[model samples]
Target: MALKDKQTEKNKHFIASLEFALQGIRTVFKEERNMRTHSLMGVLAIIAGFIFRLTTVEWLWLLFVIFFVLIIEIINTAFENVVDMCTDFHFHPIGKKIKDMAAGAVLITACFSLIVGSIIFLPKIWQLFVTYFL
Candidate 1:
């Protein structure tokens, strides 16, 4: 193919790849309960950020931790699927260990996000309470 044709083909492939990724996200969201929960948490965090009127740096930190937890959860889900496939959905100690580790990763990231969220929001919440309730 010509150089211009190759560039056009690459662009087409990039768009198609993005579509495939989006489709995967949709499937995961539909099939995985944890994904739905994580998505809900992310939405709640966004709402809290708006309510608090977070500063730009605080917004960046909040968004980063939210997405970090979600990305880890997605990876954990993928690991679970792969482990299940590899073990033929049967009992296997190694497979159990792999799945456990993946879950632990998700848990750790979630805890990290919780800590970051507390750091960012607790003061705002306290101030609001003090201003209104005290």
Candidate 2:
């Protein structure tokens, strides 16, 4: 009986956790600018994958990179907002460092995604050119 009660409690907690997660998703879509940008990037990435005729594995890798950048951007934005909320004054070295570090993370992720995209697409483009005109 105790084991069954524990299992029931666990199920209830899981359902409540899922509800909270859904609310978070709704709030992210409703209020986050970075989320909007990420959504746009996701759409572009899907369109590009189709246009480039990527193999299934290559498309998976490309989407991974795209999602990785967006995830990093969202985390970075969250960090910045939290820092800003905690500090309202200018010229605070710690605050500046925190924001700078977060921004640097986003920049690094963006550069990495760019490199992955180039590596995946450049060869295919060259081959298409050769097949068409050479």
Candidate 3:
């Protein structure tokens, strides 16, 4: 293909690739309860951030951590899926270990992100409630 033709082909398929990616997201969200919970938490965090009017840097950090947890959760799900596929739903110690590690990763990331969210938002939230009472 000519250079310009190749470029055109790539451009044409970009939207298709995005559609496929979105489809994956939809399927995961539909099938995974944890994903649904995380998405709800993410939305609530966004709402809280807006309510508090977090600074640009604070928003960046908050968003980074939020997205970090979510990305890890998605990876963990995919890892578990691959493990299950390999083990064919049978009882394998190694498969169990692999799945446990993936779950642990999600747990660790969620905890870390919770700390980050608290650090960034807790002070502001405390002030809001404290002032209302005072």
Best by TM-score: 1
lDDT of every predicted structure (CA atoms): 0.91, 0.81, 0.89
Report backbone clashes per prediction.
0, 0, 0
Ranking by lDDT: 1, 3, 2
Quote the positional error of residue 53 for candidate 1 in Å: 0.3
Q: TM-score of each candidate?
A: 0.91, 0.74, 0.88
> Residue-wise lDDT of candidate 3 within 53-114, one digit each (tens)?
99999899889988888888889889888988998889799999988999999999999989
**Model 3 weakest 10-residue run by lDDT:** 3-12
Best by lDDT: 1
Q: For residues 13-65, what per-residue lDDT tens digits would candidate 1 score against the true structure?
A: 99999999999888889889988998899899999999889999999999999
Candidate 2 lands at a TM-score of: 0.74
> What is the Å distance of residue 87 in model 3 from its true position?
1.0
| C-alpha lDDT of residue 96 in model 2 | 91
- Model 1, C-alpha of 122: deviation from truth (Å): 0.6
CA RMSD, predictions in order: 3.4, 4.3, 3.5
Candidate 2 per-residue lDDT over residues 12-63, each given as its tens digit: 8999899997886677678777678777877887797899888988888898
Clash count, candidate 2: 0
Q: What is the TM-score of candidate 3?
A: 0.88
